[model samples]
Target: MPPPEPGDVINYIYLFAHEAAAGRDEGVKERPVLVIASDAMGVAVVPITTKGEARSSRSDRIPDPVARAMGLPRAGESHVVVNDVNDFDWRGHDVIDLKTGSFLYGRCPPTYFQKIVRAVQASAALITDRR
Candidate 1:
């Protein structure tokens, strides 16, 4: 049970985001979202403080990091499917973002869905060592 490598932890940002977007738009496979890599790019620094770490940052902070890190546009502006890229999709757990509730991604009371999404995300790690 070693700690997740930087890349695995890094992708968690997208995993949560993709989960949120999926719930927001259940019918669509692609959904744009924002991210923040803790401004550690180019410095050769593996910051352990990405937005996904504390889940305290505002969801609005997403685009800045994604744009800076992956050259991706802000969420809602461009379309990216969670499964299409290296991102996660329908991992079985429903996703819930309390912070984004009714503010950025347009939702609420994430407690209900949070556990579901978490379970799904957790189950996703079953077959692959991606977790």
Candidate 2:
């Protein structure tokens, strides 16, 4: 598979803030993650969650139409938690394929992606760089 690019959404075993704080190296669940940036060092991604209460003040909601366009599961509302990002190798073992036999759900629209980027820049969230 080709290297992941910004805007790509993929299922991954994303380590949550609480988990990492507790000294856990592995995430308990596999969920969707938005690729925010990538380079020779690794990739930076933010977790997407359907649980509204889990979202931080520095987050962006994915519109219903945009979520559908991105092929996200029709579960419910989704939000990208900009306050919590994870950095790991580009081809981390935590990355997983969807049921459809692919590692990607779809790409986030450029416009929406820009909004996310802006949020991230304004956020003081601590990045969990595990590279």
Candidate 3:
């Protein structure tokens, strides 16, 4: 499969801040992440979780329509935690394959991606740099 581009939603083992602070080197489980940026250096992604409330300042809710478009399950709402982004090499070891011949769940629409970018920029989210 080709390298993931910005706007792609892919399953990843995203190590959270608390986990890292506790000396845990890995995430607890695989979860979806939004590929906010990708370049020669690596990719920057924000974790998508079902944990945030709507209109939360630290997170941007993924609309049901958009989530469906991205092939996410219809189980519940997902939010992009804009305040915590993870940076790592493209196709890094933390990436997980969903047994679909690719790591990608699907791509977010351009407009929605732009909205996410705006939200991230507006927040004081910490960008955790990792290999």
Model 3 per-residue lDDT tens digits across residues 1-131: 34588999999999776566679888888899899888876899988888784233378778888988887864257888887788898668999889887788998999999999998888877777778
Q: Give residue 9's error in model 2 in angstroms.
A: 0.6
- Structural similarity to truth (TM-score) of each candidate: 0.19, 0.91, 0.88
lDDT of 1 by residue, 1-131 (tens): 12222222121223333334446323122222322111222100011222332232212123343433433324323222211122223231212323334112322123422432343344332111112
Q: After superposition, how far is residue 111 of candidate 1 from its true place, in Å?
A: 26
**Residue pairs of candidate 3 with colliding backbone atoms:** none
**Residue-level error in angstroms, candidate 2, position 77:** 1.4
Q: Candidate 1: global Cα-lDDT?
A: 0.26
lDDT of 2 by residue, 48-112 (tens): 88875362335667898888766678535888888888999868899998888988988898999
Model 1 lDDT-worst window of ten: 36-45
Candidate 2 global TM-score: 0.91
lDDT of 3: 0.82
Off by over 4 Å in 1: 1-27, 32-60, 63-66, 75-131
Error of 2 at 83 (Å): 0.5
* Candidate 2: C-alpha lDDT: 0.83
